[model samples]
Target chain A: MKTETKAVDIDRDKGDFAYPEVHVRDAGRGLSEKTIHYISDVKEDPDWVREFRLRGLKTFLEKPLPTHWASKDLEAIDFDKIRYYLSPGTGAKRSWEEVPDDIKRTFERLGIPEQERKFLAGVEAQFDSEAVYSNIKKAVGEQGVIFVGSTEGLKNHPEIFRKWFGKVIPIGDNKFSALNSAVFSGGSFIYVPPGVKVKHPLQAYFRINAESFGQFERTLIIADEGSEVTYMEGCTAPKFETVALHSAVVELVALKGAKLQYITVQNWSSNVFNLVTKRGLAHEDAEIKWIDCNIGSRLTMKYPGVVLKGRKSRGEVLSIALANNGQHQDTGAKMIHAADETTSNIISKSISIGTGRATYRGLVHVPKHLKHCKNNTECDALLINATSRTDTYPAITVRGTGNSVQHEASVSQVSAEQIFYMQQRGLTEAQAMSLSVNGFVNDLVRQFPMEYSVELKRLIELEMEGSVG
Target chain B: MNELRVENLHVAIGDQQIVRGLSLAVPRGEVHAVMGPNGSGKSTLAKVMAGHPDYHVTKGKITMDSEDLLALEPDDRARKGLFLAFQYPSEVPGVTIANFLRAALQSRLPEGEEMEATEYYAKLYEKMELLGMDRSFTSRAVNEGFSGGEKKRTEILQLAMLEPKYAVLDETDSGLDIDALKTVAHGVNSLRGSKIGILLITHYQRILNYIVPDHVHVMVQGRIVRSGGKELALELEERGYDWARAGADEPVLTR
Candidate 1:
C-alpha cells in the first residue's frame, strides 16, 4: 500500500470526461447556508424543502463530531473544503440519446445501459451530485410504480413524497444524516402502489468525477400495502490525491404486508470517505431486508438499520465488507423490535488484507414488553496478513422473557497447512488463499442477486492477489 | 532409470532427525511396500520426498526420471508429475471437489490455455464411477464433512485425475473398512502400468493383501532393515515387526 500522498491534481476534465468543451455548472466549493440555498435555487425546490435544508444545516453545525468511533478518519475530512453540489450543466434526460456525450461515455464505461437492458426495470445514473438520466420501463411505470429522482419526486409527486419523507429516518438521526439532509442531492425515490410487485430490480449508479467533492444523496423508498420491490445501487470514483466525502441518507418504509429489499454495492476510490445512515420501518406483517457489499474506500462507516414498528414484522441484513491495504471498513446492522412477535437476523462477514482494518459494530434490541421477539446475529472476520486487523462490538439488549436470541462470532486466519494442502494438489499459493477466502464468505455471497454475486466473486479474486507472501 | 530414486536421504523436523541415511528406489511398472512399526519415519520419508516445508532435507538426493526433484516447489513438483495421497487429507471448505481438481489440472497446462470443462467433467464422472462415488460429490466442498472412507476415495479420485508419473500413498488404508479397502485398492491397482511408479507406506500388511506389491521392504528407525519379495510381507505379518525392530537396532546407517 502506498501511504504517501500523490501529487496528482484531480483534473475533472481528464479521463472521465473526454469532451473538455462540455461545461459542468456547479454550486461551487464549501458547505454553508449559502451553498444550500444555491442548491435549492438550482433544483427549484419548494419552500418547505428549503426550510428543511436550513434547519438541517443548523442541526449539523450544532452537533459535535463523533468522538468514540472511527474518529480518526472522520477528523481527516475538512467540511469547509468539500464541493457540496455539482451538475454536468444538463438536466435529467428521460431518453439515453438525450444525455450529454461526455456523461454518456462515463455510464457506458460503467455498463449502466447494458445492465438496465438486462435485469433492471429502471435506471437512474447520477454523476457527482445530480442525476443525469432516469428512465423506467413502460410496463413497470404502468403498474403504478413511481421511480424518479428525489428532487423530481418531491416536485412532481408531492402528496406521495411528503407523507413518508423523513418519517422513517428523521433529519437529525445522526450528524452525518443531518449533513446529508442539508446538502442532499441526486438519489433514487421509489414508491410501489398497493399489491403491485416490481418483477425486476431498479438500479441507481452514482459516480464522483470531480476532486474534493462530497456526494450526499438522499434516497427514500416506500412500499405500500401488500407490495414488493427490490432496489440496488452501486457507486465508484476515480483515484485522486485529495479526499472525497460521500454521506448519504436512505429511509425505507414497508407498509402492512409489504416486502422490500434494498441492496448496495459500493467500490469507491482509496481517497473517499464513505459515511452513510440508512434505516427502514416495517409495519404489520411486512418484511424489510438490506443486502450490502463494501469493497474499497479509505474509510467507511455504515450500518443499515430496521425498526419493526408493528406486530409480526421481520427484518434481515446480509452484508459483506472487504478492506484492502490503506482502507478501513466499519459496517454492521441495527434491528429494533418494538412490537410483539417480531423477528430479525443479521449476518456480517468481513475480510481485511495487508494493513487494512475492518470493524463490525451492531445493535440488536428487544424491549421487555415485546414478547416472542426473536433475533439472531452472526459475525465472521478473516484476516489475510499479520498486520491486518478486525474488531467486533455487538450490543444486544434482550429483555423479553419468551424470546430466543443467538449470537456467533469467529476471527480466523488462513492456515499455512491449508495453503500447502492446496499447493500439493497443484494450485498456486495465491489461488489457494483466494479459494479459502471465497469459501469463507460463500454462504453469504450466495444470497446476493446473480448479477452482483458473480461480480463480487471476481472482485474478491482481484483483491486476494499478492495478498500472501 | 525411469523411476523415483532416493539416495542417502537424511531429513529432519527441527532438531530431530527422521529419515536417517535412507535409500530406496521404485522403478516404473513396480509397486514397492514399506512396512514398519510406529515412529519408524516411513511417513516422514514420503513427506520429505514430496518437499514438505516442515521436514528439512539435511542431506539427500531425490530424483524423478534423473531430474532434480528437490529444486522445485511443491506445486511445481506436482506439475512435474509428483503426487502424495495424504493419510489425513485436509478439508477445503467452500471449494468444490470439481473446482479443486480443475485447478490442479489447470496448473499443468501452458499459460492462456483453458481446460475443456466438458472433457474434465466427463473424466471426473468416469473416475467417480470407478471409485463407486456418487456423482453429487463433485459439487460438495473438497473433503469437507466427508467420512473416512469418502476422504480416501476423494484422494484416489484426485490421483486418478492428475495421473502423476510417481505417487507416494502414505498409509492410504489407515481408516478404511473391508469394503472401502477393496474399492480403494481397486482404484490404485487400475493405475498400475509401465508409465507410473507406486510406493505404498503402511504399518500393517492388511492393505497389501488387496493390492499385491512387486517387492516388500521392512523399515525401522528411518532405514530399510530388510528387503525381499512379496512373500516377505506375509512372513512379517505372521512374525510381527519385532524382527524388523531387532534388526534396526544394529545401526545400519550406511547408504
Candidate 2:
C-alpha cells in the first residue's frame, strides 16, 4: 500500500559513491599460480582446496571465451589488469559494532542494518574479498538452520559443504565459472535442516569498494527434505574510471519435497563486466525457483539454469533485466528435464533504453526416454528509443512422445500515441515512459519480495529519467 | 476571459491541413456541443487543445481563462485544468487503474509532497461509484481487454476523478449502447457546476437527447457554419448533416 510518490524519494545515486580502500591483505595484480597460492596461504586453506584452486586455474588458462554465441565485447576484458583479492584481514564479525568503521558506514549508507532489523532473519554483508559481518537470529538458529560465510562453512561443516561444492557447477562448466573457482571468496553458504522450514528470508549484500579489482563470490544453498527456504542477495559497486570484473558462481540443491527460492538484485557500475553462472538441482517432488533482476553493468552475461533430476520435480525462473545507454544485458534461463513428468517455466522481461542492447538466450531439453514432461517459456523485450535493440534465441529439444513445450517471444516499443494518452492524464514524458516500462515488467516484478519490488520500481524510474528529451 | 477559448485556430498534420480557421468558446458553467459529420476536424481540435505532438498549431491561440494553453506541455496543460477523453483510449498493459490514477494525481503535487493514500482511495471509490463502475475495476489494467461500454465508462470515471476546469470529450458516445450512453451522461451531468466547463464533440445528436447542451454549433469543413440554442440540435437531428454541409458557403451565424 505504499504510495508511488513516497517510493520515488529513493536516492538514485546511492551506489555511485566510493570510500578509500583499507585492506590489510592484497593478492596483488593479475591472475597466476603465485596469486592463487597467495590467496590460499592467506586463508590457510586445506591441501584439497589448494589443489582444487590449481586445477581451476589450469582450466581457466586453457579454456577460451564463448565468443561464438556471445558479444564480442568479451574480447575487451584484460585478466592481467585486475586485482584478484583484497581483504580487510578480519574474520566475519558476529556483531555490527565489530565491523570496521569505514565498512560500517558503507553498509549504513546502503541501509543494510535497518533492513536487517526490519525483516531479515539473518544477514551477511561482504565488502570486497571477505565478509565483514554475519549474523543470524538466535530463535532461527536454534531450529538447526546453518547460515554462514562459505569459508566458515567449509571449515565448520565440511561434511555437508564438501559433498556439494563444485558438484552442481564444476570448474570447467564455462570460462567464467572456471575463473570464479580459481579465486572465489565471501558469498553466503546456507543449509535448512530437514522438515524445519525457515519462516523469513536470509539476505547477503556484496559491495566492491576498490578500483581496478575483480570480485568472484561463490554461493551455495541446500534445502533439506520437506523444508522450505528463500534466500536473497543484492550487489552494488562504486563507479570507477577503470574497468572492473565481477564473475560469480551460484549452485542450489533442493532435496525431496523441498522448496527453495533464490532471488538476486545486482546494480553494478557501468565500468564493470558481470559474468556469472547459476544453476539448481531439484529432487523428487522438489521445487526450485529463481528471481533475478539485473540493472547496470557495461556488459552482463548470465543464464541461470535448473536440472529437474527427479520425478515430478518443478523449476521456475522469473527474470527482469534493464540495459541503459552504453550497456549490454545478455541474460536468460535453462531447463533440463532429466526425469519423467517434470515441469518447468521461464518468464523473462528486458528493457533497452537509448543505445543499450538486451539479449535472451534460453535452452530447454527433454530426452526421448522421458515421458509427459512439460515446459513453457516466454520472453518479452521493450525498446524505449529508436536506437534500442533486443534479440532472442531459444533452443528447445523435446524428443519424447507425449512431451510438450511452448515458447513465446515478443519485441515491442512504447508507441507515441500511448505517451500522448498518458500525458493527457497529467503525467510528464519521463513519468509516462517510466510507468509504461514498469507496466511492461509488472507481472515478473510481483514475484520479488515486497521491499525488493518497491526498490525495483524505484530503480526502473531512475533509469527512465533523462531517457526522453 | 473566464472560458476555454480557441481563436481562429489553424491546425495541420504534416503536409495536410485538418482544422482551418476554426473559432469557438465555451464559458464556465456552460455545456457546449459541437455537432459535425465524419472527417469534419472535430477530433483534431480536441487533439490540438491537448498538445498532441503530431498536430502542429500553425496559426491560432488556445487559452484557458486568461492563460495561454498552447504555450504549455500536454501534461502541464492537463494540470492547468484541461482534459481530453479520447475516442480510442490507449491500452496500457499491466498498469492497473488505481496505479494510473495515483500517478496522474501524484504528478500534480509539488516536489517532496505526498498524496494521502486513504483520502485518495476514498475519493477514487466515490468517483467510480458515480460512474457506475464496480470496485473491482480499480485493479484491472487500463482499457486492456475492456468492452466498448466499459471503456467509455472508465473514461468518465477518470474525468470525474481528475476534475478539470474544462473537458473536451471526443466521440464519448460513439461505441456506447443506449444504457451506457445514459450512464455516461449521468456521470457528466453530475460534474456540471459553476467551476467547470464542458465541450462535448460528437457526430450524431443521439447523446444530446440524454445530456442536453446549453448551446449547439454545427460544423462543416473544419468551420462552425451555424450556432444556436438547444433547438439547433433537434433541427439537425431531423434534417441530418446534409443540411449543415449545404450551408458551408454561407457566413456563420453565431449566437
Candidate 3:
C-alpha cells in the first residue's frame, strides 16, 4: 500500500494575492531601443552586453508573431501596453533574514525556505524582474559548484558564462527569445566542475507580483565533462485583470560524458501568457533530460529542444500539461540528432477540461550522414468534457541508413461509465476526475522528484475542483 | 427496518424502460438471489440500486435502514453503505487495486481523519489472502488485463474491504471457470455476517450451488414473477426460464 501524506492544502486562490509594487527602477510600459537602453543602464551591463541587447532589440522588432501555424491568441499580446522591466534595486541577498520584508513574506508564503531546508542544495527566489534572494549550501559551494543569479554569474564567471550564453538558443531564435534577451533580468546560472556530481537539486522560484508587466528571465546551466546535476524551477503569477507576459530563455549545456536534468513546473494565473524558449546541447557520451509540467495559464507555447552534437549522446523529454476552462496549453519537444549513434525519446501527456484545449507539436530529425540514430515519440491526450479539445502534430524526418524512428499518438475521453465505477467505490465526482487524470499521467509523474510529484498531484486536484457538477 | 428495500420501483434509460414496478427487500444478515433470463433487466436493477447516472428512476423509492438512497450521490450512497459489483468492471488504467480500495475506504472517514497505514495494509492483505490473491496483486492496475476470474475476485476483494451494509452483485459468475467461481464464492461467503445484506443476481443457477442464497426470486422482463426458498432456484434450473416467462404476461405481486 502507498503511504498517504496529508492532502496538500492548495487552495484554488493560494497564489491570487499580490503586494504593492515598490521598485526603484521601472522601464515604463512599451518596448523600444530606449527601453532596452534603460534596462541595460540600470543593470550596469558591460559594453558588449549592452551591444548585445541593442542587437536583440533590433531582432525583436524585425521578427513577427508566429501566427502562420500557431494559435490566433498570439495576436492578443499587446507589447506596447506591458511594462518591460521593474526591479527593487536592492540586489540579491545571501540570507533570508536580509531579504526585504515584503519579498521575504511572499517566498515564505510559497514555502520556499522550508523547501530549501528540506532537500535543496541551493535556492534562488526571484520576484518580478530580479532575484531578491539567492544562496547555495556551504557544502555544495565547497565542492566548487557555482550557483548564482545570472547577472552575478556574468560579472564573476565571465570565462564560463560568456562561453555558453545564448549559444544553445540564439538571440534571434524566435520572437520571444529575442524579446527575453533584450530585457532579461533575473534567472538562475549554474555550473558544475569536471567529475563533480551534485547530490541534491538546486531550485529557483519565479514570482510575478505586478500587473500589466512582462517578466523576462535568462537562465543558463553548464555541466562540465563527466559531471552531473539536476536543476528545477517553478513559476507563479497572481491573477490580474490585464494580461501578464512571461517570456523566458533557458539554455543548458552538457559537456562530454556529463549528465544534466532540468525540470520546470509552471503555474501561471489565468491572465498570463507564458511563451518561453528552452533548449540544450549535449556532447559526446553526455545526456540531457527535460521534465516539464504546465497548468493554470491562459495560453502557453513552449517546446524545449535538445541538440545531440556528439556521438553516443542521449536526449529525453517527459512532459505533462493540463488545460482548464479558457486555457490553452500548446507544448511539446524537439530532438535534433546531429551525430551518429545518438538516441532520443519524447513522451507527452495532456488533459483538456471544459472549453480548454491542448495541442502537442513535436519534431525529430536525423540527417543523412547520421548512422545508427534512433528516436521514439509518444503523445497522448485526454478530454474531460464534451467541449474539450486536443490535437497532435508530429514531424519526423529520418534520412540515414541504419536509423530508426517511431511515433504513436492517441486521444481518449474519460467515459461516463468510468466515472460511475469510481463513484460507486466512494470517490466524489471531482475526486474521481482527479484520480483518473493522475492515472493518465502516472508513468511520467514517476520520473519527477518526490516533492515535485506530490506538488503536481495537488495542483491537478485543485484544478479539478469546481470543474464538475 | 434494517434492510435494503425497493418499493414499486420503475427505472429507465433514456425512454427505454428497463425495470418496471419491481419491488424486493433484503434485510441485514441475509442474501437474496435474483435469477433471470437474458434481457430480463437484472443488471439494470443492480446499476439503478447503486445510483448509476444513466438509469433514471422515474417512479421508485430505494432505502437502506430507513435512509433515502436516491437522494444521495453515487459516492455518498457508497459511503452510506451500498455496493455494486459490475458485470464488466471498467479497466482503470494506472490505478492500482491497493490505491483504488484505499480511496474508497478513505472517502468514508470523517474529514481530517486519516486511515492508519499499518492497520489498512494488514486488513487488505488479510482480505487478499482470503481471496487466494498473491500479495503483488495489489500493485496491478485495477482490472486492466485481468482474466475473467481475476475480475470477479477483485470485485469480491473490494466487497470484503469496504464491508458495506448492502451489496448488489450483477452477473458475478458470467465468465468464470469452475475453479475461479468457487474461489470467488468462497470469498463472498466468508463475508456473510449479521451486519451486511447482499443481493446476488445471476443468469445461471450454477452459482447458487456455491453461494446458496437465503431467498430466491425469479424475474421476467422487469418484475419478479415468483419468490420462494432456495428450492426455487433448483425448480427453475430444471424447468428453464421458459417456465418463468410463461407467467410474465401477468404481473405477480410477490411482496
Candidate 4:
C-alpha cells in the first residue's frame, strides 16, 4: 500500500514564461570587497551581519577553486564578469496589485500566484536578488507559523533568527557556501511553531531574469519540537550566451521529534552554473529528508546532506538528475550518523542524453562510537545515447562494529530490445524512448505530489523531444 | 479478404540464415499452429514478421491485405494490426501495465484526440477480468518480477486489448502450468472471431488441446514440411518431429 501522508511528498507550479529586463540597481560586473559591502549596505544590515558578510568575502577569496572534481567545468565561470546583485527597485509586494506591471505579468505567465491560491500554504517569489512578493495563508499565520524573506525574518524575529543562523551549516563549509554567505540577498525564512503541522507546502520560486548575473539566495527553515513542514522550491533562468551563476546555501533544523521535508526542482538554462550547499540537522527522533530534482543547467554540483545529531533520528535523500546535451549534473547525498541507532537512506537516479554527462558522488559515514547505525544507498544511471557518459564515486566509511551500510550502484543503457518492445505496442520510436526514460526515473517521481509529478512528466517529455532521430 | 501472407520468406541474422524459404498464410478467422522442434526457426519467423532489427530478411515478400508489411517499421506494422507475443517478454521496470496499455491504445487514435480515461479504464478492467488478473496487477510494472504464468497471461491480456488483426504467439505456452495454460488459452480463445487471425507457434502440443487450432503445420529447417488439420498435432505428439524431419529431408534435385 502506498501512503500519501508522508512528510516529504510532491507538489508543482505550472507555466513557462519570462519577462524583459528591468534592473534598477546593478552591482556591475565584478566580485570585490566593494561589491560585498555594496550588497550589505543596500540591504541595510546590522553591524554583525555586515561584518559577517565582509568576513565571508575574505574567506571566499582565500578559498581556492575546487580542484578535485568538476574542476574543468568550474573554470568556465568568469567570476569577474558576473554581476553580483540586481533588483527591479520594487520592494516586497503584499498584494498582487502592488507588484509592478511587468513583474506581475511574468509571475502570471509562470502561474505562481494561481498555484499559491490553489494549494500552497505560503509563497515567496525571488526575481533577481530580492523577493518581489511574499504571502502566507491567514489560518496558517494564525497558527503561529512565520514565513517571510530571510532579510525580513532577521529584522523582525532576530532572537529566533540568530539562534540558528549559520549554526547548522556555518561559513566556509565550502567555496560556494562562502560565496553565498558573502553576497546572499533573498530567499525564504520559515519557522513552524511547536506542535503545529503545516498541511500544504510552503514554496519559493527563484527566477533569474537578468543575463550575465548571479542570484545567491539564502534559505533557513527551522521546525520546532514536534512540528512538521514541507517546503518546495523551483528555479528557472532564461537562456543566455554567457554564463549566469546561481550559488545558494540552505540550512534546515528539525528539533526534537520534529519533521521537515525540503524539495527542489531546478530547471536552469544551459548557460547557468548552479553550485549549492544544503544541509540539515536532526535532533532526537526527528526526521529530515531532501527530495531534489535537477533537470537543467550547464553544470551543477550539489549534494544535500543530513547530520543525524540525536538518538534514533532518521535522514533520507531522494534525488533525480537529468543531463542533456552540453550539460553536466554532479549531484548526490551525504549522511552522517552522529548518534546511536540512527538510520539513513539515499536513492539517486540520473539520465544522460546525447553527449551529456552525469556523476554521482556520495558520502556515507558512521563514526566508530555509534552503535546500531544503518545506511542504505542506491545510485542508478541511465545512458540514453551511445556517446552519453556517467560515473559514480561513492565514499562510504563505517567504523563501528554494529553498523550496517549497503551501497549499490549500476549504469545501464536503454536497451534496444526494450524500446523495440514498446515500439511494437504501437508507439513511435520517440514515444518509446521517452517512455523508457520516464520509467527510469518513475520510482523517484512518484514520491512527488501529484501535480508536480504530472508536470515533471511533461517536462521530461519535452526534454526527450528529438533525443532520437 | 484480410490475410497475412509470406511467400518464400528468407531471413538471416548477420550472415547465418535463420528462416530459409519459409512460406505460410493465415486468412481472417483462422488459427494456424506451427509445431516445430528446437532451432527449427519457429520463433525466428515470428520475430521476422514483427520486423525485429536483428533479423535481416534477405529475400521475401510479406503482405497484409495487399500492403507490403516488410517495408513498414515495427510500430507502423503494429498500428496496421500486426502483433507478436514474444517468447521472452521484455521487462519494463517502473512502467505500470495500466500506463503502458493506455499509451498503446492512445497511439491508435488520431493525433490530438485523447482517450477517454473512464472508458479506457473500464475496458482495461474488463480485459483483465477476462484474463483472470487481479485489478491490482494493472498498477504493477509491465512484466517486472512477474512469474512465468503471469508474464504469459499479461501477454494474452495485451493481445485482447490490442485486438490485432493478426497475432503471432511464439512459445506462449513454454513456461506455463496446466492451470496457467488453460487461463492463457481461454483469454486467447475469447478474442477469436472472423476479424482476427492467430498463428500459434509452439514446440509442445499441450496448448493445442485448449486452443484447438484450425490447422497445424510441421516446420523443419525453416520450412513448412507438412500441413494438416488439427489432428496433425496429435499425430506429431504421438510420433515425434523426427518422422517429419526425415520425410521432408529427402534431397530434391533442383538442378
lDDT of each: 0.82, 0.84, 0.84, 0.83
lDDT of 2 by residue, A245-349 (tens): 899899999999999999998887677799999999999999999999998888999999999999999999999999999899999999999999999999999
Tens-digit lDDT string for candidate 3 (A1-469): 1222333223334343232233457788998989988998888998878888888899999999999999999899889999888764322223333223443344444445454421111112233323332234455678898887788789889999999998999989999999988888888788999999999887664222211123688889999999999998874322222237889899999999999999988877677789999999999999999999888778999999999999999999999999988999999999999999999999999999899999999999999988999999999999998889999989899996899999999999877888999999999999999898888998898899987787677667777777788
iRMSD (Å) of candidate 4? 0.6
lDDT of 1 by residue, B86-168 (tens): 98888888889998899899989998799999999999999999999999999999889999999999999999999999999
Least well predicted 10-residue stretch by lDDT in candidate 1 chain B? B246-255
Q: List the residue pairs that clash in candidate 3.
A: none
Error of 3 at A148 (Å): 1.1
Residue-level lDDT of model 3, residues B1-255, one tens digit each, is 999998888999998998898989999999999999999999999998888888899997989998999999999999899999999999888888998999899999999689999999999999999999999999998999998889989999999999999999999999999999999999999999998999999999999999999999999899998889999999999999999889887766655
Residue A455 of model 3: what lDDT? 67
Task: Enumerate clash totals for all models, in the order shown.
Answer: 0, 0, 0, 2
The window of 10 residues in a row where model 1 chain A has the poorest summed lDDT is: A14-23
Give the range of the ten consecutive residues with the poorest summed lDDT in model 3 chain B: B246-255
Off by over 4 Å in 4: A1-22, A89-137, A206-214, A235-243, B249-255
Number of the top candidate by TM-score?
2
Ranking by TM-score: 2, 3, 4, 1
